[model samples]
Target: MPSSPPNPQLAKRYISYTVDDIARLFGIHRHTVREWIKRGLPVIDKQRPLLVQGADLAEFLRKRRDARKQSCAPGQLFCLRCRVPREPAGWQVVYRPLTATQGTLNGLCGTCSARMCRRVSLAKLTAAAGNLAITTTQAGEHIDECPTPIVNRDFKEG
Candidate 1:
Protein backbone atom coordinates (compact mmCIF):
# COMPACT_ATOMS: atom_id res chain seq x y z
CA MET A 1 0.00 0.00 0.00
CA PRO A 2 1.24 3.52 -0.92
CA SER A 3 1.16 6.32 1.69
CA SER A 4 -0.11 9.83 0.86
CA PRO A 5 2.24 12.68 1.78
CA PRO A 6 1.10 15.50 4.10
CA ASN A 7 -0.15 18.78 2.54
CA PRO A 8 2.28 21.48 3.81
CA GLN A 9 -0.21 24.19 2.84
CA LEU A 10 -2.62 22.90 5.51
CA ALA A 11 -0.22 23.56 8.40
CA LYS A 12 -1.96 24.79 11.58
CA ARG A 13 -0.78 28.07 13.03
CA TYR A 14 -0.85 29.06 16.74
CA ILE A 15 -2.58 32.38 15.99
CA SER A 16 -6.27 33.14 16.62
CA TYR A 17 -7.88 34.66 13.56
CA THR A 18 -10.64 37.23 14.06
CA VAL A 19 -13.70 37.53 11.79
CA ASP A 20 -11.70 40.03 9.68
CA ASP A 21 -8.78 37.59 9.45
CA ILE A 22 -11.06 34.81 8.32
CA ALA A 23 -12.66 37.08 5.71
CA ARG A 24 -9.29 38.32 4.38
CA LEU A 25 -7.84 34.80 4.33
CA PHE A 26 -10.87 33.55 2.43
CA GLY A 27 -11.13 36.65 0.20
CA ILE A 28 -14.66 37.34 1.43
CA HIS A 29 -16.31 40.22 3.24
CA ARG A 30 -16.24 40.20 7.07
CA HIS A 31 -20.05 40.28 7.09
CA THR A 32 -20.00 37.01 5.11
CA VAL A 33 -17.99 35.32 7.88
CA ARG A 34 -20.50 36.59 10.44
CA GLU A 35 -23.31 35.27 8.25
CA TRP A 36 -21.56 31.88 8.05
CA ILE A 37 -21.23 31.81 11.82
CA LYS A 38 -24.94 32.63 12.07
CA ARG A 39 -25.77 29.95 9.51
CA GLY A 40 -24.30 27.27 11.85
CA LEU A 41 -21.14 26.25 9.96
CA PRO A 42 -19.21 23.79 12.14
CA VAL A 43 -16.70 25.33 14.53
CA ILE A 44 -13.62 23.22 15.22
CA ASP A 45 -13.45 24.13 18.90
CA LYS A 46 -15.12 26.43 21.41
CA GLN A 47 -12.71 25.58 24.22
CA ARG A 48 -11.05 27.99 26.73
CA PRO A 49 -8.18 28.59 24.30
CA LEU A 50 -10.31 29.38 21.22
CA LEU A 51 -9.02 28.02 17.94
CA VAL A 52 -10.49 27.49 14.47
CA GLN A 53 -9.66 24.36 12.53
CA GLY A 54 -7.50 24.86 9.43
CA ALA A 55 -9.63 22.27 7.57
CA ASP A 56 -12.86 24.28 7.95
CA LEU A 57 -11.20 27.51 6.70
CA ALA A 58 -9.59 25.65 3.81
CA GLU A 59 -12.95 24.18 2.74
CA PHE A 60 -14.68 27.59 2.86
CA LEU A 61 -11.87 29.30 0.96
CA ARG A 62 -11.81 26.60 -1.72
CA LYS A 63 -15.56 26.93 -2.36
CA ARG A 64 -15.45 30.76 -2.50
CA ARG A 65 -12.40 30.80 -4.82
CA ASP A 66 -14.02 28.31 -7.19
CA ALA A 67 -17.24 30.35 -7.35
CA ARG A 68 -15.37 33.61 -8.02
CA LYS A 69 -13.27 32.04 -10.77
CA GLN A 70 -16.37 30.73 -12.51
CA SER A 71 -18.33 34.01 -12.38
CA CYS A 72 -18.24 36.83 -14.98
CA ALA A 73 -16.74 40.22 -14.29
CA PRO A 74 -19.15 43.10 -13.45
CA GLY A 75 -20.46 45.53 -16.10
CA GLN A 76 -19.22 43.37 -19.00
CA LEU A 77 -21.53 43.74 -22.00
CA PHE A 78 -21.61 40.98 -24.60
CA CYS A 79 -21.80 42.27 -28.18
CA LEU A 80 -24.60 40.82 -30.25
CA ARG A 81 -23.01 41.46 -33.66
CA CYS A 82 -19.48 40.18 -32.97
CA ARG A 83 -20.37 37.91 -30.02
CA VAL A 84 -17.73 39.63 -27.86
CA PRO A 85 -17.26 42.85 -25.91
CA ARG A 86 -19.11 45.74 -27.62
CA GLU A 87 -18.46 49.46 -27.73
CA PRO A 88 -21.51 51.28 -29.08
CA ALA A 89 -20.39 54.16 -31.31
CA GLY A 90 -23.40 56.38 -30.65
CA TRP A 91 -25.73 56.12 -27.65
CA GLN A 92 -27.79 58.40 -25.46
CA VAL A 93 -28.73 58.20 -21.80
CA VAL A 94 -32.02 59.44 -20.38
CA TYR A 95 -33.88 59.01 -17.10
CA ARG A 96 -37.54 58.32 -17.81
CA PRO A 97 -39.40 58.42 -14.54
CA LEU A 98 -42.92 57.08 -14.19
CA THR A 99 -44.09 60.29 -12.59
CA ALA A 100 -42.00 62.81 -14.54
CA THR A 101 -40.75 63.70 -17.99
CA GLN A 102 -37.60 62.12 -19.43
CA GLY A 103 -34.29 63.77 -18.49
CA THR A 104 -31.38 63.65 -20.92
CA LEU A 105 -27.74 63.38 -19.93
CA ASN A 106 -24.72 64.68 -21.85
CA GLY A 107 -21.07 63.51 -22.25
CA LEU A 108 -21.88 59.96 -21.06
CA CYS A 109 -19.87 57.15 -22.69
CA GLY A 110 -22.13 55.47 -25.25
CA THR A 111 -20.60 52.03 -24.65
CA CYS A 112 -21.27 51.97 -20.92
CA SER A 113 -24.19 54.39 -20.64
CA ALA A 114 -27.88 53.52 -20.37
CA ARG A 115 -30.03 53.52 -23.54
CA MET A 116 -32.83 56.10 -23.70
CA CYS A 117 -33.23 58.28 -26.74
CA ARG A 118 -35.95 59.52 -29.10
CA ARG A 119 -34.56 58.25 -32.43
CA VAL A 120 -35.47 60.93 -34.94
CA SER A 121 -35.05 61.19 -38.70
CA LEU A 122 -35.53 64.17 -41.01
CA ALA A 123 -36.70 66.68 -38.38
CA LYS A 124 -39.37 64.37 -36.95
CA LEU A 125 -39.51 62.03 -33.92
CA THR A 126 -39.70 58.40 -35.00
CA ALA A 127 -42.65 56.24 -33.96
CA ALA A 128 -42.29 52.53 -33.21
CA ALA A 129 -43.03 50.33 -36.23
CA GLY A 130 -41.50 47.45 -38.18
CA ASN A 131 -38.40 49.00 -39.87
CA LEU A 132 -40.39 51.75 -41.58
CA ALA A 133 -39.55 55.07 -43.18
CA ILE A 134 -41.65 58.09 -42.18
CA THR A 135 -43.09 60.68 -44.54
CA THR A 136 -45.51 63.57 -44.06
CA THR A 137 -48.35 63.98 -46.54
CA GLN A 138 -49.29 67.35 -48.06
CA ALA A 139 -52.26 67.38 -45.67
CA GLY A 140 -49.83 66.82 -42.69
CA GLU A 141 -50.66 63.13 -42.09
CA HIS A 142 -47.60 61.11 -40.99
CA ILE A 143 -47.48 58.04 -43.23
CA ASP A 144 -45.48 55.17 -41.68
CA GLU A 145 -44.17 53.16 -44.63
CA CYS A 146 -40.99 51.31 -45.49
CA PRO A 147 -38.80 52.52 -48.31
CA THR A 148 -37.92 49.52 -50.51
CA PRO A 149 -34.43 50.34 -51.73
CA ILE A 150 -33.29 48.47 -54.84
CA VAL A 151 -30.48 45.97 -54.24
CA ASN A 152 -27.90 45.51 -57.01
CA ARG A 153 -26.32 42.04 -56.90
CA ASP A 154 -23.28 41.23 -59.00
CA PHE A 155 -23.40 37.44 -58.58
CA LYS A 156 -20.74 35.47 -60.47
CA GLU A 157 -22.36 32.40 -62.05
CA GLY A 158 -20.16 29.39 -61.55
Candidate 2:
Protein backbone atom coordinates (compact mmCIF):
# COMPACT_ATOMS: atom_id res chain seq x y z
CA MET A 1 0.00 0.00 0.00
CA PRO A 2 1.15 3.56 -0.63
CA SER A 3 2.56 5.36 2.37
CA SER A 4 0.71 8.50 1.33
CA PRO A 5 -2.37 9.02 -0.78
CA PRO A 6 -2.11 10.30 -4.35
CA ASN A 7 -1.64 14.05 -4.60
CA PRO A 8 -4.80 15.85 -5.69
CA GLN A 9 -2.64 18.85 -6.51
CA LEU A 10 -1.38 16.95 -9.57
CA ALA A 11 -4.84 17.03 -11.13
CA LYS A 12 -5.79 19.83 -13.48
CA ARG A 13 -9.11 21.18 -12.21
CA TYR A 14 -10.29 22.23 -15.64
CA ILE A 15 -9.91 18.77 -17.20
CA SER A 16 -12.32 15.85 -17.50
CA TYR A 17 -11.15 12.26 -16.99
CA THR A 18 -12.18 8.79 -18.11
CA VAL A 19 -11.77 5.79 -15.80
CA ASP A 20 -8.65 4.64 -17.62
CA ASP A 21 -7.22 8.16 -17.63
CA ILE A 22 -7.72 8.52 -13.87
CA ALA A 23 -6.13 5.12 -13.23
CA ARG A 24 -3.12 6.08 -15.35
CA LEU A 25 -2.83 9.54 -13.82
CA PHE A 26 -3.01 8.20 -10.25
CA GLY A 27 -1.03 5.01 -10.93
CA ILE A 28 -3.87 2.81 -9.76
CA HIS A 29 -5.71 -0.06 -11.44
CA ARG A 30 -8.60 0.86 -13.71
CA HIS A 31 -10.90 -1.22 -11.48
CA THR A 32 -9.96 0.93 -8.50
CA VAL A 33 -11.09 4.02 -10.39
CA ARG A 34 -14.34 2.26 -11.22
CA GLU A 35 -14.77 1.35 -7.55
CA TRP A 36 -14.36 4.99 -6.67
CA ILE A 37 -17.33 5.81 -8.86
CA LYS A 38 -19.47 3.22 -7.09
CA ARG A 39 -18.20 4.56 -3.75
CA GLY A 40 -19.62 8.03 -4.46
CA LEU A 41 -17.24 9.58 -6.95
CA PRO A 42 -19.55 11.66 -9.15
CA VAL A 43 -19.71 11.14 -12.89
CA ILE A 44 -20.76 13.23 -15.87
CA ASP A 45 -23.85 11.13 -16.76
CA LYS A 46 -25.01 7.69 -17.81
CA GLN A 47 -23.07 7.90 -21.10
CA ARG A 48 -20.93 5.52 -23.19
CA PRO A 49 -17.55 6.61 -21.74
CA LEU A 50 -17.84 7.52 -18.06
CA LEU A 51 -16.30 10.91 -17.35
CA VAL A 52 -15.19 12.38 -14.01
CA GLN A 53 -14.20 15.99 -13.72
CA GLY A 54 -10.63 16.55 -12.54
CA ALA A 55 -11.91 18.89 -9.85
CA ASP A 56 -14.33 16.26 -8.56
CA LEU A 57 -11.72 13.51 -8.68
CA ALA A 58 -9.23 15.63 -6.80
CA GLU A 59 -11.81 16.60 -4.22
CA PHE A 60 -12.91 13.00 -3.83
CA LEU A 61 -9.38 11.78 -3.32
CA ARG A 62 -8.69 14.57 -0.87
CA LYS A 63 -11.78 13.74 1.14
CA ARG A 64 -11.01 10.03 1.06
CA ARG A 65 -7.47 10.68 2.30
CA ASP A 66 -8.76 12.98 5.02
CA ALA A 67 -11.27 10.34 6.13
CA ARG A 68 -8.45 7.87 6.81
CA LYS A 69 -6.51 10.27 9.06
CA GLN A 70 -6.04 9.07 12.62
CA SER A 71 -4.89 11.80 14.94
CA CYS A 72 -3.34 10.90 18.30
CA ALA A 73 -4.68 12.64 21.34
CA PRO A 74 -2.75 13.31 24.56
CA GLY A 75 -0.64 10.37 25.83
CA GLN A 76 -1.49 8.41 22.72
CA LEU A 77 0.53 6.93 19.90
CA PHE A 78 -0.74 6.10 16.46
CA CYS A 79 -0.36 2.35 15.90
CA LEU A 80 0.74 1.77 12.35
CA ARG A 81 -0.49 -1.80 12.31
CA CYS A 82 -3.88 -0.99 13.79
CA ARG A 83 -4.34 2.29 11.95
CA VAL A 84 -5.67 3.97 15.06
CA PRO A 85 -4.46 5.96 18.06
CA ARG A 86 -3.71 3.90 21.16
CA GLU A 87 -2.38 4.59 24.61
CA PRO A 88 0.86 2.95 25.63
CA ALA A 89 0.68 -0.28 27.62
CA GLY A 90 1.22 -0.26 31.39
CA TRP A 91 1.07 3.52 31.38
CA GLN A 92 4.82 3.62 30.78
CA VAL A 93 6.61 5.53 28.02
CA VAL A 94 10.23 6.15 27.05
CA TYR A 95 11.28 9.63 26.08
CA ARG A 96 14.28 9.46 23.78
CA PRO A 97 15.80 12.85 23.09
CA LEU A 98 16.59 13.72 19.47
CA THR A 99 17.76 17.27 20.17
CA ALA A 100 17.87 19.86 22.91
CA THR A 101 14.14 20.51 22.87
CA GLN A 102 12.59 17.77 20.71
CA GLY A 103 12.35 14.05 21.34
CA THR A 104 10.16 11.01 20.66
CA LEU A 105 7.83 9.16 23.01
CA ASN A 106 7.85 5.42 22.49
CA GLY A 107 5.36 2.96 23.89
CA LEU A 108 3.53 -0.30 23.26
CA CYS A 109 -0.04 -0.46 22.07
CA GLY A 110 -2.30 -1.71 24.85
CA THR A 111 -4.49 -3.61 22.42
CA CYS A 112 -1.95 -4.97 19.92
CA SER A 113 1.28 -4.68 21.93
CA ALA A 114 2.94 -3.20 18.85
CA ARG A 115 5.70 -0.63 19.25
CA MET A 116 4.55 2.90 18.68
CA CYS A 117 6.34 6.24 18.76
CA ARG A 118 5.30 9.88 18.64
CA ARG A 119 7.38 13.02 18.32
CA VAL A 120 7.12 15.39 21.27
CA SER A 121 8.70 18.56 22.54
CA LEU A 122 10.48 18.75 25.86
CA ALA A 123 8.51 21.84 26.82
CA LYS A 124 5.16 20.16 26.18
CA LEU A 125 6.18 16.69 27.34
CA THR A 126 4.00 16.89 30.42
CA ALA A 127 0.86 17.67 28.49
CA ALA A 128 1.60 15.07 25.84
CA ALA A 129 2.55 12.38 28.34
CA GLY A 130 -0.51 12.96 30.48
CA ASN A 131 -0.65 10.34 33.25
CA LEU A 132 1.95 8.01 31.79
CA ALA A 133 5.21 7.45 33.71
CA ILE A 134 8.06 8.82 31.61
CA THR A 135 11.60 7.43 31.48
CA THR A 136 13.93 9.95 29.89
CA THR A 137 16.91 8.55 28.01
CA GLN A 138 19.59 10.08 25.77
CA ALA A 139 20.14 8.86 22.24
CA GLY A 140 23.53 7.26 21.64
CA GLU A 141 26.29 9.45 20.25
CA HIS A 142 27.71 8.81 16.77
CA ILE A 143 30.22 5.93 16.64
CA ASP A 144 32.97 7.98 14.98
CA GLU A 145 32.65 10.67 17.68
CA CYS A 146 33.61 8.20 20.43
CA PRO A 147 36.82 9.12 22.27
CA THR A 148 38.30 5.63 21.79
CA PRO A 149 36.61 3.33 19.30
CA ILE A 150 36.90 -0.48 19.65
CA VAL A 151 38.36 -0.94 16.13
CA ASN A 152 40.99 1.77 16.69
CA ARG A 153 41.80 0.38 20.16
CA ASP A 154 42.44 -3.13 18.70
CA PHE A 155 44.71 -1.87 15.90
CA LYS A 156 48.30 -0.84 16.85
CA GLU A 157 49.99 2.16 15.15
CA GLY A 158 53.45 1.66 13.65
Candidate 3:
Protein backbone atom coordinates (compact mmCIF):
# COMPACT_ATOMS: atom_id res chain seq x y z
CA MET A 1 0.00 0.00 0.00
CA PRO A 2 1.15 3.60 -0.71
CA SER A 3 1.76 5.95 2.20
CA SER A 4 0.11 9.36 2.36
CA PRO A 5 2.22 12.45 1.64
CA PRO A 6 3.02 14.95 4.35
CA ASN A 7 0.66 17.87 4.77
CA PRO A 8 1.71 21.14 3.10
CA GLN A 9 1.43 22.87 6.45
CA LEU A 10 4.15 20.60 7.75
CA ALA A 11 6.20 20.55 4.53
CA LYS A 12 9.48 21.96 5.75
CA ARG A 13 8.23 25.04 7.53
CA TYR A 14 10.78 27.87 7.65
CA ILE A 15 12.90 27.83 10.79
CA SER A 16 13.80 31.50 10.76
CA TYR A 17 13.37 34.87 9.02
CA THR A 18 14.99 38.29 9.41
CA VAL A 19 13.26 41.29 11.02
CA ASP A 20 12.96 42.91 7.59
CA ASP A 21 11.09 39.92 6.23
CA ILE A 22 8.70 39.92 9.16
CA ALA A 23 8.16 43.69 8.88
CA ARG A 24 7.56 43.59 5.14
CA LEU A 25 5.26 40.58 5.28
CA PHE A 26 3.33 41.83 8.30
CA GLY A 27 3.23 45.59 7.45
CA ILE A 28 4.81 46.65 10.71
CA HIS A 29 8.09 48.15 11.82
CA ARG A 30 11.01 45.90 12.70
CA HIS A 31 11.17 47.49 16.13
CA THR A 32 7.51 46.60 16.65
CA VAL A 33 8.35 42.99 15.93
CA ARG A 34 11.13 43.06 18.53
CA GLU A 35 8.88 44.84 20.99
CA TRP A 36 6.16 42.22 20.60
CA ILE A 37 8.72 39.51 21.16
CA LYS A 38 10.00 41.32 24.25
CA ARG A 39 6.42 41.53 25.54
CA GLY A 40 6.31 37.69 25.72
CA LEU A 41 4.54 37.04 22.43
CA PRO A 42 4.42 33.30 21.70
CA VAL A 43 6.27 33.86 18.40
CA ILE A 44 9.67 34.77 19.85
CA ASP A 45 12.16 32.09 20.95
CA LYS A 46 15.21 34.38 21.48
CA GLN A 47 17.73 31.49 21.51
CA ARG A 48 19.03 34.02 19.04
CA PRO A 49 17.87 37.43 17.88
CA LEU A 50 16.76 38.65 14.40
CA LEU A 51 15.58 35.21 13.40
CA VAL A 52 11.90 34.24 13.50
CA GLN A 53 10.17 31.10 12.29
CA GLY A 54 7.67 30.95 9.43
CA ALA A 55 5.00 29.82 11.87
CA ASP A 56 5.46 32.96 13.99
CA LEU A 57 5.34 35.26 10.97
CA ALA A 58 2.24 33.59 9.61
CA GLU A 59 0.43 33.89 12.90
CA PHE A 60 1.40 37.53 13.42
CA LEU A 61 0.56 38.55 9.85
CA ARG A 62 -2.78 36.82 9.98
CA LYS A 63 -3.65 38.74 13.11
CA ARG A 64 -2.31 42.27 12.38
CA ARG A 65 -1.74 42.93 8.68
CA ASP A 66 -5.31 43.63 7.78
CA ALA A 67 -5.75 46.43 10.30
CA ARG A 68 -2.81 48.49 9.07
CA LYS A 69 -2.48 49.80 5.51
CA GLN A 70 0.13 51.78 3.58
CA SER A 71 0.14 53.70 0.32
CA CYS A 72 3.81 53.90 -0.52
CA ALA A 73 4.84 53.76 -4.17
CA PRO A 74 7.08 51.02 -5.46
CA GLY A 75 10.83 51.46 -4.75
CA GLN A 76 10.04 53.80 -1.86
CA LEU A 77 11.18 53.04 1.67
CA PHE A 78 9.42 53.58 4.95
CA CYS A 79 11.05 56.07 7.28
CA LEU A 80 10.93 55.13 10.96
CA ARG A 81 11.57 58.72 11.91
CA CYS A 82 8.65 60.20 9.94
CA ARG A 83 6.23 57.26 9.95
CA VAL A 84 5.87 57.43 6.15
CA PRO A 85 7.45 55.97 3.06
CA ARG A 86 9.29 58.25 0.68
CA GLU A 87 11.77 57.99 -2.14
CA PRO A 88 15.32 57.74 -0.83
CA ALA A 89 16.93 61.15 -0.44
CA GLY A 90 20.48 62.20 0.37
CA TRP A 91 20.09 62.28 4.16
CA GLN A 92 17.13 59.93 4.60
CA VAL A 93 18.92 56.93 3.14
CA VAL A 94 20.28 55.48 6.36
CA TYR A 95 20.23 51.67 6.33
CA ARG A 96 20.47 50.20 9.80
CA PRO A 97 20.40 46.43 9.54
CA LEU A 98 19.42 44.51 12.68
CA THR A 99 21.70 41.60 11.82
CA ALA A 100 24.62 41.57 9.45
CA THR A 101 23.33 38.52 7.64
CA GLN A 102 19.83 40.02 7.30
CA GLY A 103 21.14 42.71 4.95
CA THR A 104 20.00 46.34 4.99
CA LEU A 105 16.84 47.45 6.79
CA ASN A 106 13.97 49.49 5.36
CA GLY A 107 14.36 53.04 6.62
CA LEU A 108 11.84 54.64 8.95
CA CYS A 109 11.03 58.30 9.46
CA GLY A 110 13.61 60.20 11.51
CA THR A 111 10.98 60.76 14.20
CA CYS A 112 10.23 57.04 14.33
CA SER A 113 13.90 56.22 14.64
CA ALA A 114 14.23 58.66 17.54
CA ARG A 115 11.15 57.16 19.15
CA MET A 116 12.62 53.71 18.82
CA CYS A 117 15.85 54.85 20.44
CA ARG A 118 13.91 56.37 23.31
CA ARG A 119 11.90 53.22 23.78
CA VAL A 120 15.05 51.14 23.91
CA SER A 121 16.62 53.44 26.49
CA LEU A 122 13.42 53.29 28.51
CA ALA A 123 13.47 49.51 28.43
CA LYS A 124 17.03 49.52 29.75
CA LEU A 125 15.97 51.84 32.53
CA THR A 126 13.08 49.56 33.43
CA ALA A 127 15.39 46.57 33.52
CA ALA A 128 17.79 48.45 35.79
CA ALA A 129 14.90 49.21 38.14
CA GLY A 130 14.23 45.49 38.53
CA ASN A 131 17.80 44.93 39.77
CA LEU A 132 17.80 47.74 42.35
CA ALA A 133 18.98 47.06 45.92
CA ILE A 134 18.67 49.16 49.04
CA THR A 135 21.44 48.89 51.63
CA THR A 136 22.46 50.64 54.88
CA THR A 137 25.93 51.46 53.58
CA GLN A 138 24.84 55.04 52.93
CA ALA A 139 24.27 55.48 56.68
CA GLY A 140 28.00 54.78 57.33
CA GLU A 141 27.58 51.49 59.22
CA HIS A 142 28.22 48.11 57.71
CA ILE A 143 25.64 45.37 58.37
CA ASP A 144 28.34 42.65 58.36
CA GLU A 145 30.24 44.35 61.20
CA CYS A 146 30.20 42.79 64.71
CA PRO A 147 31.16 44.22 68.10
CA THR A 148 33.65 41.39 68.60
CA PRO A 149 36.30 40.42 66.06
CA ILE A 150 35.43 37.36 63.98
CA VAL A 151 39.02 35.99 64.40
CA ASN A 152 40.52 36.84 67.77
CA ARG A 153 43.55 34.87 69.11
CA ASP A 154 44.97 35.47 72.64
CA PHE A 155 48.75 35.83 72.23
CA LYS A 156 51.00 36.13 75.32
CA GLU A 157 54.20 38.22 74.99
CA GLY A 158 57.32 36.07 75.17
Candidate 4:
Protein backbone atom coordinates (compact mmCIF):
# COMPACT_ATOMS: atom_id res chain seq x y z
CA MET A 1 0.00 0.00 0.00
CA PRO A 2 1.19 3.53 -0.72
CA SER A 3 2.02 5.71 2.24
CA SER A 4 -0.56 8.36 3.10
CA PRO A 5 0.35 11.95 2.39
CA PRO A 6 1.21 13.92 5.51
CA ASN A 7 -1.46 16.54 5.06
CA PRO A 8 -3.49 17.53 8.09
CA GLN A 9 -5.22 20.42 6.36
CA LEU A 10 -6.97 18.18 3.85
CA ALA A 11 -8.69 16.26 6.63
CA LYS A 12 -10.13 19.43 8.13
CA ARG A 13 -12.17 20.50 5.10
CA TYR A 14 -15.08 18.14 5.72
CA ILE A 15 -17.37 17.70 8.72
CA SER A 16 -18.81 14.36 7.63
CA TYR A 17 -18.93 12.08 4.60
CA THR A 18 -20.82 9.23 3.04
CA VAL A 19 -19.07 6.18 1.58
CA ASP A 20 -19.50 7.57 -1.90
CA ASP A 21 -18.18 10.96 -0.85
CA ILE A 22 -15.07 9.42 0.69
CA ALA A 23 -14.50 7.24 -2.37
CA ARG A 24 -14.78 10.21 -4.69
CA LEU A 25 -12.50 12.39 -2.57
CA PHE A 26 -9.81 9.73 -2.30
CA GLY A 27 -10.24 8.45 -5.87
CA ILE A 28 -10.95 4.96 -4.61
CA HIS A 29 -13.86 2.58 -5.01
CA ARG A 30 -16.89 2.85 -2.72
CA HIS A 31 -16.28 -0.78 -1.83
CA THR A 32 -12.88 0.21 -0.43
CA VAL A 33 -14.52 2.70 1.89
CA ARG A 34 -16.91 -0.02 3.00
CA GLU A 35 -13.94 -2.27 3.62
CA TRP A 36 -12.35 0.42 5.77
CA ILE A 37 -15.60 0.55 7.74
CA LYS A 38 -15.32 -3.20 8.29
CA ARG A 39 -11.75 -2.68 9.51
CA GLY A 40 -12.82 -0.34 12.36
CA LEU A 41 -13.48 2.97 10.66
CA PRO A 42 -15.97 4.72 12.91
CA VAL A 43 -19.38 5.55 11.50
CA ILE A 44 -22.73 6.94 12.59
CA ASP A 45 -24.98 4.00 11.70
CA LYS A 46 -28.21 5.35 13.19
CA GLN A 47 -29.37 6.79 9.84
CA ARG A 48 -29.79 5.06 6.48
CA PRO A 49 -26.86 6.59 4.59
CA LEU A 50 -24.32 5.83 7.38
CA LEU A 51 -22.37 8.96 8.03
CA VAL A 52 -18.63 8.99 8.76
CA GLN A 53 -17.52 11.93 10.87
CA GLY A 54 -14.52 13.81 9.55
CA ALA A 55 -12.82 13.95 12.94
CA ASP A 56 -13.22 10.20 13.43
CA LEU A 57 -11.86 9.41 10.00
CA ALA A 58 -8.92 11.71 10.50
CA GLU A 59 -8.04 10.08 13.81
CA PHE A 60 -8.37 6.60 12.33
CA LEU A 61 -6.15 7.39 9.37
CA ARG A 62 -3.57 9.10 11.57
CA LYS A 63 -3.34 6.08 13.83
CA ARG A 64 -3.04 3.74 10.85
CA ARG A 65 -0.22 5.83 9.40
CA ASP A 66 1.56 6.04 12.72
CA ALA A 67 1.41 2.27 13.13
CA ARG A 68 3.04 1.81 9.75
CA LYS A 69 5.79 4.26 10.73
CA GLN A 70 6.79 2.25 13.80
CA SER A 71 10.55 1.73 14.24
CA CYS A 72 12.31 -1.01 16.18
CA ALA A 73 14.02 -0.23 19.48
CA PRO A 74 17.80 -0.45 19.83
CA GLY A 75 17.81 -4.18 20.55
CA GLN A 76 14.98 -5.27 18.29
CA LEU A 77 14.22 -5.90 14.62
CA PHE A 78 10.88 -6.19 12.92
CA CYS A 79 10.04 -9.78 12.05
CA LEU A 80 8.21 -9.77 8.72
CA ARG A 81 6.92 -13.31 9.10
CA CYS A 82 5.72 -12.76 12.69
CA ARG A 83 4.49 -9.24 11.88
CA VAL A 84 5.89 -7.87 15.15
CA PRO A 85 9.06 -6.39 16.64
CA ARG A 86 11.33 -9.03 18.11
CA GLU A 87 14.77 -9.33 19.65
CA PRO A 88 17.33 -11.53 17.96
CA ALA A 89 17.54 -14.99 19.42
CA GLY A 90 20.53 -15.29 21.83
CA TRP A 91 21.70 -11.77 20.92
CA GLN A 92 23.12 -13.14 17.69
CA VAL A 93 22.84 -10.10 15.46
CA VAL A 94 24.74 -9.37 12.24
CA TYR A 95 25.38 -5.81 11.07
CA ARG A 96 26.16 -5.03 7.45
CA PRO A 97 27.04 -1.45 6.57
CA LEU A 98 25.01 0.06 3.73
CA THR A 99 26.67 3.46 3.84
CA ALA A 100 28.86 5.58 6.08
CA THR A 101 25.97 6.37 8.40
CA GLN A 102 23.39 3.64 7.69
CA GLY A 103 23.32 -0.16 7.85
CA THR A 104 21.11 -3.22 8.19
CA LEU A 105 20.76 -5.36 11.27
CA ASN A 106 20.00 -8.99 10.46
CA GLY A 107 18.97 -11.72 12.83
CA LEU A 108 16.50 -14.54 13.41
CA CYS A 109 13.19 -14.12 15.21
CA GLY A 110 13.37 -15.63 18.67
CA THR A 111 9.98 -17.28 18.35
CA CYS A 112 9.45 -18.18 14.68
CA SER A 113 13.06 -18.51 13.47
CA ALA A 114 12.22 -16.28 10.50
CA ARG A 115 14.87 -13.92 9.14
CA MET A 116 14.40 -10.47 10.66
CA CYS A 117 16.02 -7.25 9.47
CA ARG A 118 15.89 -3.54 10.26
CA ARG A 119 17.63 -0.51 8.82
CA VAL A 120 19.50 1.43 11.50
CA SER A 121 21.82 4.37 11.79
CA LEU A 122 25.48 3.38 12.06
CA ALA A 123 26.07 5.61 15.10
CA LYS A 124 23.15 4.14 17.03
CA LEU A 125 24.24 0.63 16.06
CA THR A 126 27.76 1.27 17.24
CA ALA A 127 26.43 2.34 20.64
CA ALA A 128 24.23 -0.74 20.82
CA ALA A 129 27.11 -3.04 19.84
CA GLY A 130 28.90 -2.24 23.09
CA ASN A 131 26.36 -4.37 24.98
CA LEU A 132 25.19 -6.96 22.44
CA ALA A 133 27.07 -9.76 20.66
CA ILE A 134 26.91 -8.44 17.08
CA THR A 135 29.00 -9.46 14.11
CA THR A 136 29.96 -6.57 11.85
CA THR A 137 30.45 -7.06 8.11
CA GLN A 138 30.97 -4.95 5.01
CA ALA A 139 28.11 -3.81 2.79
CA GLY A 140 26.39 -6.59 0.77
CA GLU A 141 28.24 -9.34 2.67
CA HIS A 142 26.00 -12.33 3.43
CA ILE A 143 26.48 -14.13 6.76
CA ASP A 144 25.97 -17.88 6.61
CA GLU A 145 25.07 -18.41 10.26
CA CYS A 146 22.53 -20.97 11.43
CA PRO A 147 19.52 -19.90 13.46
CA THR A 148 20.11 -19.84 17.17
CA PRO A 149 17.95 -21.97 19.49
CA ILE A 150 15.11 -20.14 21.14
CA VAL A 151 16.02 -19.07 24.68
CA ASN A 152 12.81 -17.45 25.85
CA ARG A 153 10.96 -20.07 27.84
CA ASP A 154 7.65 -18.27 27.42
CA PHE A 155 7.56 -19.11 23.74
CA LYS A 156 5.46 -22.17 22.94
CA GLU A 157 5.89 -24.65 20.08
CA GLY A 158 3.14 -24.72 17.48
In terms of TM-score, the best-performing candidate is: 2
Ranking by lDDT: 2, 4, 3, 1
Candidate 4 — which residues are off by over 4 angstroms? 1-66, 128-130, 143-158
User: What is the overall TM-score of model 2 with all chains considered together?
Assistant: 0.52
| Alpha-carbon local distance difference test for all models | 0.33, 0.73, 0.36, 0.67
RMSD of 3: 24.4
Deviation of model 3 at 20, angstroms = 2.7
lDDT for position 139 in model 4 = 63
TM-score of 4: 0.49
How would you encode candidate 2's per-residue C-alpha lDDT over 64-95 as one tens digit per residue? 66645756788887654454668989989888
Tell me which residue pairs clash in candidate 2: none
Give the per-residue lDDT of model 3 (tens digit) for 66-108.
3124434443444434434444432232222222222222232
Q: Each candidate's TM vs. the true structure?
A: 0.27, 0.52, 0.27, 0.49
Q: Between candidates 3 and 4, which one is better according to TM-score?
A: 4
